[model samples]
Target: MKQTPERILLPVSPVFIAVSLFVAFLLNLQPWGHWVGVPDFVALVLVFWGIHQPRRVGIGIAFCMGLLMDVNDATLLGENALAYTLLSYFAITLHRRVLWFPLKKQVWYILFLLLSSQLVQMLVQFIISQRTSSWFYLLDSCIGALLWPVVTAILLAPQRRSVNTDLDSSL
Candidate 1:
């Protein structure tokens, strides 16, 4: 049996986490965001950080970001906030268990988390508007789930250590 080497990751910087979340927020603000299957970038990033750095990026940050999203999208004030807070709570709760799985297996867990968040958002929308959205709205969760591995890689890049550490160089 060939064992895959596990790379040691450095501590994630708070600045990097903040920047990634900001970028996701910007992505969500794009015109195409209104389209079905566009994926909720903010939700994705929030879950990622919530799981990886629960201590630093907890429900409070999620709530604040969701509020910002709510304001930006001009939706009900607390809709996104509630959804994101719950998403963060679950991610933090499952972080330890999810970390034990391989990337492929992790996708399922992430999909579930994203879906739950979407469901919460949809429910809120339904309650406020008294109308149900098309099933296509769920596509956003599916797309976000599919992007899990890619997002993980991109976000973790900064914390990855060099494959070969040079002993000769002393700074």
Candidate 2:
């Protein structure tokens, strides 16, 4: 029997996830002061994938990616996980509308999503540290949101062709 499209894509490409995570690791490693770290590449990539392919990129993967980010950044253990999981959940839930939006509009939506994750992180940090974070904490969202098109185009180009074929067979 032929495998359904869903079956073929269900496991997803672990290699892709690994590549994304590795890129995120490198971005996080860039030497920077407390003010201007690289944008959270992992979160953006995960959001892109989650919204574009919810069946493949779900909460577990987001949680794992977040944990990896936490290890790389040495933030509180669950901080990134909490943020990523929540973000992915939201993305997947809204995938229908999000997938249909134009790239620029998608960037705006992603900005909101990214900000929500950061706000959660801030709240958790505040509860622990009893202080507010710097304005720069919000800067990464702007950079990430702005770079959404470049990032999505580069990452999804190959998948785009395949996605059409998959969609035809699945629907």
Candidate 3:
């Protein structure tokens, strides 16, 4: 039996991380964000970075991003901040375990994380508005989970090293 070699990933660039997060935030600001089944891009990206680069993208960044989301949405202050903070915390905590799983298996874990974040946001909204949102709101998390593999591929592209390296030359 032959074992497949694991591809070595280069160190992620801080600039790439920042750009990804910024793009996600912009996606969240789209008008379609309020539509059912529309995923929360910011939360998705946050979870991705939290799991893959916990040391660089942790709770503090999550909180700040959440606050920006709240301001943009004009929702009660701290609603998204609290949810995102918890999401990042949990993702960071489970980073090692998650990395051990294959991409397909990782979907289940990502689903749980995304669902929990949505639940927190829903609960906060309920508290502020005294109204219950339709159950379909959770669909966003499901969509986000389904997109996990694609997101991982896109986000990790910058860090993926070429399979063939020239030993004779140092770049």
Best by TM-score: 1
Better by lDDT, candidate 2 or 1: 1
For candidate 3, write residues 58-120 as lDDT tens digits.
999999999999999998889999999999999999999999988889999999999999899
At residue 5, what lDDT does model 1 achieve?
Answer: 92
What's the TM-score of each model vs. the native?
Answer: 0.95, 0.80, 0.94
Q: Which candidate, 1 or 2, has the higher TM-score?
A: 1
Ranked candidates (TM-score, high to low): 1, 3, 2
Q: Considering TM-score, which of the candidate structures 2 and 3 is the better prediction for this target?
A: 3
Over 4 Å off, model 1: 169-171
Error of 1 at 106 (Å): 0.6
- Model 2 over residues 1-171: C-alpha lDDT tens digits? 454333123344768766876786676666662346457888888888888778878999899888887887788899989999999999898888986667778888898998999899999899988888887889888888999999877776555434354655756
Worst 10 residues of 1 by lDDT: 162-171
